[model samples]
Target: MESYIQISKINDFIFCPRSVYLHTIYDNFHKKSYQRTPQIAGTIAHESIDTGAYSSRKRYLMGKEVYSDELSLCGKIDIYDLQTKTLIERKRKVVKIYDGYKYQLYAQMACMREMGFEIETLKIHSLSDNKSYILDMPNEEEWQKFIDIVERVNNFSVAEAKILADSKKCAQCIYQPLCHPL
Candidate 1:
């Protein structure tokens, strides 16, 4: 059977490899309904952006669903600037660029490229800071690293992928109870 991967899974693996294992291998886990203020805010922001409720003067595409058969990956891009050939991702916070975010963007970019879009730049619009970061696309080395991570996760057995229950992240994790039973 042909296996496919979601862009979110790439982020999850980067956040915690255990999350990928638990989410993919186990069917018992339940998603939490209660979202924190920040998460809620981000969701709202993304919805507005996705619905084209937030307008810009530039010619662009919003909320495009793209998939790459070559990479067997799929994701929706927040925005694609037609005139500038740039991709924009929105986030509620802008502390720093994480590997997960980078990989997510890379997957989106790869999908776009496979679809024959000319993507020249990558940008992240940080709602908290009201700042826009013009990011360089992942270089060859970073792309290789992402590919390696994907391959590792694809081959990971349930037992080999242990739960990494970090104190701070656990509080936000939906599968926390499963990982750390009281």
Candidate 2:
């Protein structure tokens, strides 16, 4: 039997399959060089939400985990407004705004949907630019797209393939030496 998959990994794979393939299949991961600005911004944003001290007039919770026997997904939701019953997913980045973040957020919303919670909205925040985008959760048709992506990830896990030789992405991975012999 295959091991269970994390919804976050699905998001990671979507961001860049090469990264995911290295992280999961080869057990390779890039080391964090230092405490970066993006990481700091995310931490502060989450702390503010969890405390409910922010002047924003929204009843929300931070860092929620939605799980199921068939699938388990967990992440820090920046804000969940009780009035609107929305789950806010946030990302703080200096450069690229990858779609992987959206995929990851959507998976979390799907998990919440499975739990019978009505998610009114899914929000993404770009800290650098101070802009927000709302992902409409009321739309059922959108879920089909996510389902297809998830299935593709599942299929990738079963296929037997060796790691590519001497790739830069491999060098940064923890399992580099094992997967690719230099």
Candidate 3:
């Protein structure tokens, strides 16, 4: 049976595979009282972007959900400009483009292409710096990389997944207590 994975899961795996195990297998998340400032800011930014109230630019389709059966991946795109064939992803802060960001966008691009949209460009709008960064569309090699990542995550056993935890990431993770107990 083909395993279905959320695009956000791909990002989580890239961020820290242990996160994937904790979220998908262990079924753990930070408690409701655990306030995440970055997450809260991101939510507000996404809401503004979704409503087309963040910028004065002409609005296109907003928060469109896309899926790819071939890859068994699904996600909601922040914006899609059909006229420019561009996909815009809003970020609360983008001090540096991380692999997780690329992987998430790659999954979205694959789903969009499978849905028959010609994607010419991928852009990340950093709300914090008020800057936009254009990302290169994934090529065949990049697509293969994404596929490999998916396969690795899907094939991991609970024990194998546990090895992906890193102390640095664990230090800042909200699920730290769940991952590491004193």
Candidate 4:
């Protein structure tokens, strides 16, 4: 059986493919002990959704595990609004809606649509800022870009100094010690 690409990896893969490469090579034991401020904040913000508390009241799907055999992608979506047919992803905060996020949302949409779920809207809610951003549907060309990114990650190779990593992204990366892209 072919292994599925994780939906969570879409952001990391776009941020820096090396992060995903380092992720696959290391075990969860090392990652378990690794916690940064942003990750901690993200976890804290997700508590309600993770425990299905938020969905219970709204009649929504909280932390729903979605998978697509066709796309070979799988991960838990934060919230699926049954009333609105919206696939909503929440973050601790969102200063700017980055491309990585848009791509991640696209991947989620693809997975959900493939799994026979209704998705008419895509949104990202910033928990801290209490803000929400709506994403426009990607054209075929844009969707193709995401597919190409997945292919790159699926066939990823570890090579030092070859990754096109930004200095800002590299500094914030959790895998900096292992990847050392700086």
RMSD of each: 3.0, 5.5, 3.0, 2.2
User: lDDT tens digits, residues 1-182, model 4?
Assistant: 88988887778887777677766666465444665668777887888888877745666888888888877888888888888999889988899988889878888888889888889999999988799999888888988998898777667666632555477867788767666637
lDDT tens per residue, model 1, 24-125: 655443333434456567778898777877776569788888988888888799899999999988888889988888778888998999999999998888
lDDT of 3 by residue, 137-158 (tens): 7778987898999777667666
Whole-model lDDT for model 1 versus the true structure?
A: 0.78
Tens digit of per-residue lDDT, candidate 2, span 1-182: 54555766676565445545655643332324322354455667666666756545546555566654444444445566778877766666534445666677777776777777787777777776878887655346656777777777766752434455546755544444444464
Ten contiguous residues with the weakest lDDT in model 3:
26-35
Candidate 1 stretches with Cα past 4 Å from truth are 21-34, 56-58, 172-182
How many residue-pair clashes does candidate 1 contain? Answer: 0
Error of 4 at 24 (Å): 2.2
Each model's C-alpha lDDT? 0.78, 0.60, 0.77, 0.80
Which structure among the candidates has the greatest lDDT? 4
Summing lDDT over every window of 10 consecutive residues in candidate 4, give the lowest-scoring window: 156-165
Worst 10 residues of 2 by lDDT: 26-35
Q: Estimated TM-score per prediction?
A: 0.83, 0.63, 0.83, 0.89
Best by TM-score: 4
**Candidate 1 — worst ten consecutive residues by lDDT sum?**
27-36
